[model samples]
Target: MTVGEVMSKDPVSIREDDYMTHARQVIRDNFLRVLPVVDEGNRVLGVLSDQDVLNIRSSKSNVTVRGYIRETPLITPDMDLLRAARELLDAKQHHAPVVSSSLDRSIVGILSDVDLLRHIQPTKRSPASVEEIMTAKVETAYPDDSISRIWDNMLHWDYTGIPVVSHKKEPMGIVTRIDIIKAGYARIGTANMHGRSSGGSMRVEKVMSTPLYSVAPESSISEAIGEILRNDIGRISVTDGGRLVGIADRHDLLRACLEGTGL
Candidate 1:
C-alpha cells in the first residue's frame, strides 16, 4: 500500500529553535521515540530520536537543539510503505518523515515501523506467541559484574542492550547502550575520565535499570507489539515464570512480517 494509507498525518513535530529538554519531554509525553524536525512553515528539516536527545543530554553539551539538526533521512509521500519500512530498518531508525515533493518537501506526515507492521500484517489472526519467535540464546550480565567487563561483553556481542541477572539466575534489570552512553557523558562532564575506568570497574548493579518490563512466552504478538508501542521501547525480554528465556526485538517482528508476506 502507499505510504499515505498508513502514515500518521499531522504528526507531533518540533521546531529547529526548540531546546533538547523540550524535545525530550515531547518524546516522553507522546510515547514517541522520534520526532520530525520542522520549520515554521511545517517544512521538513530533519528528524530526532530518543537516542539523539539522550546523547545530547549525556554529553552535557551547551548547544541548542538547532545545533543538532543535520540531514535526516526522508521519504516521499508516494513511496511504498514496504520500501519505506525497509529503509527505516536499514537505517535503524524508528520513525521517518513523509514529505510532499510538490510542496517543497513540506512535512505532511510521519511514518513509523509500527504503523507499517499494522498495515502489512493481519492483526485479527491468532497472535503469534513470543516463544515461537523469540531468540532463545539471550545474552545476559551479572549484577556484580564490573561495568568495564559488561561493556566489553556488549561490544564483543554487538548487543544494544543486555539483561542483568541475579546470582540465582533471575532477571533483575537491564543495561542498554544508551545507559552506557549516559554514563560516559556523565564521566566526561565530571572530568572523571581516569575515574571512569575505576568507575566502570565498579559493579553493574549500581547503574542498571531495575524493574524491567517483560513479556511471557505465551503472550501474543499483538500484546508484544502493544507493549513495545506503549513503552516506546525497541526490545523486550521474554520470560517464563520470572526466569529469562528469550528475547524479541523490532528486527525479529519485521522479519516475521517479511517471511509471512513472502516478501
Candidate 2:
C-alpha cells in the first residue's frame, strides 16, 4: 500500500496568520486532534494540535497559529504506507502532511493514524496479536480518584485516555483529554459559586465516557484496527476475560507497521 491510496485528500489547513482561537475552533469543529498549517499557496508549514492548546496557560485572540506551530515529518504520495507510518511515530505525531513529491512541496493530502489503520483493517498484513503492541503498565483510575491528580498524570505521561477500572480491575469507563477540557475549561470560576472547585472535586465517573470500546489481547491487530476505525476512537483497551490487560494506540500500530510484523 502507498500513502496516496489511503491518505485523506484536500486536508483542512490552518493558515499561518490565523488566530489561535480559529485553530482551536477548527480542531473542535472537525473532531481533529491535529491539523496542518499552510502557507498562502497551500504548502504545509507546520501543524497544530489540541495538546498544544492544552499546554497553553492562556491564549489571546490575536495569537496566531504561528505561535503554536509544530514542524512535522513530511511525506509523499508514492511513499510506502509502512514507511510513512514509521516517520510519523519517529516524529511523535499521529499525522503528517503529504506533499506533491515535487520541488515545490505543495500540500496535497494528510496521512493520519486513522487513515493507516483504516487501510490495515481490511488486510491480513498485521498478523500480530494485541499483546505485541499493548502497554502492559496499563495506567488506570478509580471512580473516586481526584480529577486534579488524574489530569496531572495524564499530562505527565502523555496519556490521551486512561481506563477507569473497578477495585476488581475490571473496566468501567474512560476519561480522555477532551473530556477534561470540555468539563473543566468553562467551569473554572463557576466552581466557587457552585461550592466546589472544578477538577479537585470532580469525580472520574462524572466526566468519563461510559460503555467502553475494547478488544481482547488475543485478537489480531486487524481486529483491533477494525475496532478503532469502526468506532472512530483513538485507542482500544486490551482486555482478558473482561479485565483490563492493556491498551493499543496509534504508537503501537506504527511500530507494528514499521517492522512489518503483520503480513
Using lDDT as the measure, which candidate wins?
Answer: 2
Cα lDDT computed for each candidate against the true fold: 0.71, 0.76
Q: In each prediction, how many residue pairs overlap at the backbone (N, C-alpha, C within less than 3 A)?
A: 0, 3
Global Cα lDDT for candidate 1: 0.71
Q: Local error of candidate 2 at 11, Å?
A: 1.9
> Can you tell me which runs of candidate 2 are displaced by over 4 Å?
59-62, 121-127, 146-149, 180-200, 261-263
Give the number of the best model, judged by TM-score.
2
For model 2, how does the per-residue alpha-carbon lDDT over 56-99 read when each residue is reduced to its tens digit? 43435577889788978879999887677767878888878899
TM-score of each: 0.61, 0.81
Tell me the tens digit of each residue's lDDT in model 1 across 93-196: 76888889745779888887778766665333333687888999988888878666666565456565799998899999898756665555223223432244
TM-score for candidate 1: 0.61
Query: Over all chains combined, what TM-score does candidate 2 have?
Result: 0.81
Off by over 4 Å in 1: 57-62, 122-164, 172-233, 239-243, 260-263
- Alpha-carbon shift of residue 212 in model 1 (angstroms): 6.9
